[model samples]
Target: MKKIILFPILLIISFYSIQNHATAVTKSREAYEKTGNVIWEIKTKEKLVAITFDDGPHPVFTPQILEILAKYNAKATFFVAGNKAERFPEVLRRVVKEGHEVGNHTYSHLITSKITAVKLKEELNRTDNIIQMITGTKPTLYRPVAGIYNDVIINTAIKNGKFVILWSWDQDPRDWRNPPANQITRYVTKGINPGDIIVLHDWHGSEFSQACQTVMALDDILSYLSSKGYKPVTVSEMLYRSKTNYPEPFYPFR
Candidate 1:
């Protein structure tokens, strides 16, 4: 009789363990899709474009952007520089801690559009590895340096199970060149509509601190977008909502 009871208990335990593992698998898949490029191929069917900040994790500018994001309770995606990731690991952590997603922008910020295939993979691998080290998960999303890429780069990202994310050219403002903040705000707010993705900077240069009119314009832009009945969402949340996902182990599902 004792043996019979023990056997049943053991069976129950095994069942629970299997159930838990299945749940884990589901969650992992969800993460994969959220970072996958399915959304890249599909435009924001609604008035929601992803806000992605690239080439960052800089000391001063990164923090400023994070602070504003915190203030507005806004979430955006940060496509980090790999070498900078190693240099300023804390900034990367702060980004995660503050409820934002981190994606790979490559180690050297070399434009994948220009590099050879071998070099592209090497750069992506190194950057993805370092980002995983800091964030505890490898990103399946790849935003080429300076939003630059070709068919080869896009194909490479797809082949590696990564989605190549691009931007909608609504607001650039040339902040990298120290464009005026008011003008930047005017353009971004005026141009923004439903399902629009506004690109901005986080950490970059001394001029970037002055150049990034985005941070300053956040209040006006957010307010305007809100008035227009659009909600600001991070890249991951946008993808997740749209049912975009990657495969397990952060690679192509098929």
Candidate 2:
């Protein structure tokens, strides 16, 4: 008799808990929808662009990219995968130490569609914690894995105080596929525009050699930006500049 009574009570508690969670998610989604939190690119008249790298802090390739950036005195944002960053905390620290910005790229590079809302939040929080513990700073920028996102993903990020960052559609060179260095350079140089966010990769799976191409292309890309009199800055820096330099949001959908 006690077990039967306890079972119904437990069921009631579970139902209420689920309902509360659903209500919270719904409220978050509706609230954020009123004022969008997604940023694709920024608009400005000045020759400034934010170049960002995803899936990085690779033990080998990351150092090479940093060296190239240092050579040009350019700053870029690195959206680091938490698992990789945890393994290479030193490399991540170097990225910040060298005056670059870091963003959260999820704990295990999880696909949004494949995970539950709770799981997604867990991933973001875990990555945030890992980054904070290692660098003493929690990332406020988040670029979802494979750039896949939805209402749940956006709301979850905003609830955690992260802005969903995406690159300009034309600025992606797909460097992870290991294209020729010159080709990658040409694609970036030709497509770059003021306030554009360029996306590149600094880490590729086990094959370290695959990421070398991006490092090679980065050297020339930076040189080209210099010749064009364009300044490369971090995403946060670009956003800050937009507030003062150009007061218009450059979202493509708008």
TM-score of each: 0.75, 0.82
Considering every candidate listed, which one attains the maximal lDDT?
2
Clashes of each: 11, 0
lDDT of 1 by residue, 145-233 (tens): 77665555665777776766666666565555546677867877777665566777776464235545666766676677667777677
By summed lDDT, which 10 consecutive residues of candidate 2 come out lowest? 245-254
Residue 164 shift from truth in candidate 2, angstroms: 0.7
Task: Write candidate 2's Cα lDDT for 1-254 as tens digits.
Answer: 99999999999999977865563233343354345567788777889999999998898999999999999999999999989999999999999888889999999987545455688889998999999998888888899898776667777788887888888889999988988999999999997899999999988767355447898899999999999999998888888777743223222101
- Evaluate residue 46 in candidate 2 and report its C-alpha lDDT on the 0 to 100 scale: 82
